[model samples]
Target: MINTRPRLAWHRARLLTIGVAVWAAAAALLTPVAASAAVDNPAPTPLVSFTFDDGMQNALTQAAPTLKKYGLTGTSYVNTSCVGMTTVPNTCRASTDVPYMTWDQITQLQNTYGWEIGSHTVNHLCLVSVGDDCQATKLTAAQVDAELANSKATLAAHGFNATAFAPPYGDYDMSVLAQIAKYYSSMRGFADTGNNPWPLGDYLIRNIPVQERTTPVATLKARVDEAITNKTWAVFTFHDIRPSPSQNPDDYQYGTAELDQLAAYVQSKVAAGQIKNVNISKGLVNGSPNLLANPTFNNGIGDGWRTDAPSTITADIGNTGSFPDSARSVKMVSGSAAGHLFSPKVPVTAGTNYLFKSFLNVAAISSGEVGFYVDEYNAAGQWISGQFRKRENTRWVESMNFTYTPSSTSVASASLQVYVTGTGITAYLDNVQMLALAAGSTPPASVNLVTNGAFDAGISSGWTTDSASTIQADGANRGSPANPVNSVKLTATTATRHLFSPQVAVTPGTYKIASYLNITARTSGEMGFYIDEYNAAGQWISGQWKLGVSAAGVTNVDLTYSPSTSSVAKASLQVIVQGNSGLQAYFDDVRWTKS
Candidate 1:
């Protein structure tokens, strides 16, 4: 029975009384972190947004109270067709029982509870799905357009902003979206259950459905637990919630206690600053590359963040407008034991610089040091190292920025976290972001894979070739004539001529196909290299080709490629120097590396 603390610094000072105890040792010992998670899929943050589709009356009566008790809010989708028309009470069939929300009740939830109202459609139209909430008629694009547009217009007309849509039966095509795109900001779709990656398609947000009879309370908690652990985004969909066992209950409907349990868990994590329960519209807003989702804490306590376990730290939202342009910022109060607040993991490119900035306002955080860091992890999902950013607890007047560079290409995700130490720590963080520096920034380290890379061992078993070309030991054109030659010269007379490397085994990382080309002579045609990939079973996956040329001196020609499981583990590298019959080329250190 963990009790949540009040959300503001001032309120906690006067009203602080109770605290909850937890089995911190047992929890940490049992749970192991997993890698292979889709890295920084969305704007970082483990967000779990709740949405109720089909305008059911139970949303207001049974669901709303449970949500409010847990200090939670959600977006509920409605279709204008059955806004108020519900079945008579005391029935026992899907066709005979259950109730639909009236327009008044829907408005009350929006106006009174700060809940978002989204469009389902003018009708619950489905193009393919044959489930509940499906409008079986194969609607035309124009018909779908009208349904989407009219519903959005109606909700707006009634004072609901109605920015996002929840497709009935999770059915929609590009044509349907292109039309709806005219009026809505984003759309919530069923089936796909995970975070909405940036540039956030806005057209199709994924969701997971939950029910009392099917999705147990423990399962619901586990789903959110995974999202929190991975720092990913997820949306949960639900329907009716009745007090007692419903004989003819729809699989989508839930019992009150189940909903209560789920809500209570959300509240606990939110109070601990572990995750965010946001509305779909939050992701659709002016998509940018900055990761750290819900940085402002607008989604309440649970929006994808976490603090220490079994600790006396209390967390909640607070109005920090006194700090200039402040909105809603998270407020955490430290008890005797020092606590930490960890941010969601953000994916980054190795050797690339990432810029991070954040705004902080403190309330009497005297004495102890406030620490900021970049916790880096490898592709295996294990914490490899950490980079310190801010070691001072300096009071911020406005904002601060920090930049860090990862050391290896195998680096997967980097999460931001802050440690508070000292007497009575209380603070708020707002407007934070972590962005990957664009290409043409600091360069990555390169690795050479060509055996006898300098050809010091002479033209040998490493390179396979066609009859059109041959490698000769050259001493004169290697970088300059002065040095003893360890380089090989490739002279190609035909298009099929190439010096190919044996199959190289690779893991997931960036690779460069590079060669030192000193073309003493050039005439017709193009000179290039190609990389062909193969799966574990020796099946061809894909290939890419690029060309380079320089008349005199030496030209360092190179290109990079990243391999995935989709392309398998083996790659064949080929170097082709094609031109006129006397087209001469020099090859020194040809390499492919994880850098």
Candidate 2:
């Protein structure tokens, strides 16, 4: 087996023996000089945290003993909903088997083995692709919310206090991470390069996968040795622990011999006091960013900025030729491998909000946009993208601020960049800053109500279908001008018409419309909403808008259009149903807004 030493100061110590016989080749190749240095001064030992996911039975019956034999601690994330929920014990046919452990078994393992339990999100879903967790379809945003909040309640009820979460499918984008971080202290995901053996803390940590195709026991031992030598924690994650494992598609079973070998290696480390089993979250708090010792930014005035990555510097004129002060517009002529420069790491608390600011300028030679982005990572090495960018004209300095609510990590770090887009506009930036905000003081804004239904009070804020069927408010906040509605629906025996328009011309711009409604049946006709506008001729332009429905009750629908439709003097928002059939039904709460 090829065993590589860890990256650390060149150091070495006497070959400490605890158990297994030393291979002649391995021993001879050992650097005596390096061992001597380690004996003189050892590097700070790092904390190791082990976490497992998808509680396979084999993990408990097979892997547990091995882990225990090594005096190691492990946390397993489980899907509570999967317990006793299916008759079929295994669903192992897919390329990757996705199965859940029975609650009874999971409880037994946790209670008897001192294992930490965490939620895997109920109904396991990809939250980023979908919008809100409650209202999404396959797994509605509501369902996702229920999965997280309800699972917590269930675990607590069952005496399991789970404070971490492993996003379902190991698939998450910035938006999903933002939402999930709201609930979990530590989030786990699949392994990635530069993320293996994961980092510690609330942010993305590392976990190495142990699969069927993994290297043999000897190689695994060598790697473990290297990790110990470097004082690095190596977490080995697997799905199952059995030979020729069946039924579980994701099973990465180990033979009895391999398990014994791992146990022995762990025993040696414990005997030598070379290893300490610790919780993953604790590791993050203890690990510190490798800050640059003499970070400098050439592009800023007086070189006041410090960044780990290289930055571009350019020259210009401003305060230099003026009376008050000497100011030269310094531009970062280029970006580095790490993107832009950021301040040294600062401690942050989860559940709290924070504001980060940086000074930037746009030069006359450049144009387009000049802005910044917030960069954060999750336990799985996933980056959490921030919102909004600051723009400036070619004239002066501007401050860009990013505000966010943190999750489990104690300190969240960010990078700031002053970039110019388009053409003929170059910008200089400096004085980047970050500040934590108090919770509940303010939250990101949300869309509460939108409507085109405008009518004078007490004048029947309903729809008038001239010569057809007229509609009135239900007086229960339904279809009322004052009370924004959600759905608009009506049931009538004959053909009906309604006059619908925003008391004011609908604001001109690209907009989206959403509402819910249903009809008893559209046996021989079509059901749809309508948008009315006017052409150069000052005549109303009507377009057929339709949304299909599945069953009874309210069917929510969303539509989009350009501002040109509402830019005219008397343009409006209208919903129309046209056909020769009777028993027409219409719905309300129709709203038009931007995405």
Candidate 3:
């Protein structure tokens, strides 16, 4: 609702008038000639940075731990005067009381977690008033110098060499930029919503805020995707990380779980080598390196792997090919005890998260289970702990991934293993991978599994109607404005008839099914959506029928369905209508997405 256009335009104008020379000089010193390519030119590698403002205490207690779980570190911009304050400081625009991180805590963030410490002025003063309080533009040039120079000095006194700056409230003008350039290498702006180009505008570095309530995890992932596609740097700003965030947007609070989810998503991208997560000081870098050697077993199992139980576990470099890549796979057979295939010992940092993944094929498992685990060791090579990550008790073929953070700081190394624990279990494992996560990682985004859900190509594209009903695409009545030019209209006889969508392949997870329907006419019965489940063998097993509605107007049909059994490997969305001869309805914009 707030118009920030005039302020942004003015900011740009001032940058050209007063900050251009400073920015050009800094760019020449920092960026290479090759880095000044066209904005459309893709970056060699996409970069992302997690940055926090105002040095909130939760940035240490909550945000740091969450980011560490994904093996990530962020930049924390601290207001020197606000450090250790239990009440809202007069320099801060915020009205509510919130604790700020202490000097010791900030040091730990830098020394222990490898986070970058940045300046946020001596007092949280807005350089120029846009609309909020704490405006300091009225103050003399000497005061502004103290705000900038003094804050950097304080950080230096505390043994932190701060190099980045973020203007409070993103309120700044030409004078502010000139002063900021004197104190820091880069300055981040609050309202700049898009990713930064290869040769960044260091003086006004753009960032997207991770606000609670308004900003969803999906939106953040999209930003990451955009950066990867455009080959740019994506910086996200955060404030308080709380277990229960206030609904007020002014609080600038986000839930801890949401942060974890975003972190997981970013970690997944890092694992896939789509983007590199870095701090503000580190412009761009390579992504997380794959720790496990010979992940595909292409060079032979002896390269970096050994069988713990040689009698039951064998390296099958022939015949059995690896998943995703045509290489080699290892096999394990259950014996009296578990058989283990251990990867080479990988050095691990304490309190940092790691992701282990492998594709597995269970040919047969009559009684027991096959598990993916990690065995931890201390610096002295003594066994510290063994963690059971994930397992499969049934016959299935899929990729299994699990994240693990060393429980004890003493843990120095880990060996990933695939073991068969049950009797008569035979499984093939391939394409094993282990990568350290950046701090604050989350799971990957899910996709819509429904085929031709919008009926764009016509009813026969991916739908089948029972003999008792006739289905046709209706362009005139598309059910909703968001829908495409066509919606499938089903007219059924006195008998109940069903129009079914193409069978969608699925894994073991929750799915959301939604569709818009318009019941133009109906005489006796109701109409709604149903999800029919199928086993791995493509045999119909069961179904979940939603409560049918008989209203003769546009209605939304939504349902959340999870597999009732592990065998459910496929599902189909069924639009069922039962009534008299005149039963007619329209269905459009059907969607089936993993939740």
Per-candidate TM-scores read 0.47, 0.39, 0.42
- Residue-wise C-alpha lDDT for candidate 2, range 180-239, written one tens digit per residue: 544555666654312323122243445666555564767666656766766565655555
454-552 per-residue lDDT for model 1 (tens digits):
455666656565542365666563531111255667776644366666677776887755544556666654455666667887666766554445345
Task: Give per-residue lDDT, candidate 3, residue 188.
Answer: 88
Quote the positional error of residue 535 for candidate 1 in Å: 21
TM-score for candidate 2, residues paired by index: 0.39
Query: Runs in model 1 with CA error above 4 Å?
Result: 1-43, 86-96, 128-136, 195-199, 245-250, 285-595
lDDT sort, best first: 3, 1, 2
lDDT of 3 by residue, 507-556 (tens): 88877776656677867667756677788887888776656777675554
As a whole number from 0 to 100, the lDDT of residue 571 in candidate 2 is 41
Report the candidate with higher TM-score, 2 versus 3: 3
Model 1 per-residue lDDT at 108: 88
Task: Please report, in order, the local distance difference test score of every candidate based on alpha carbons.
Answer: 0.60, 0.45, 0.69
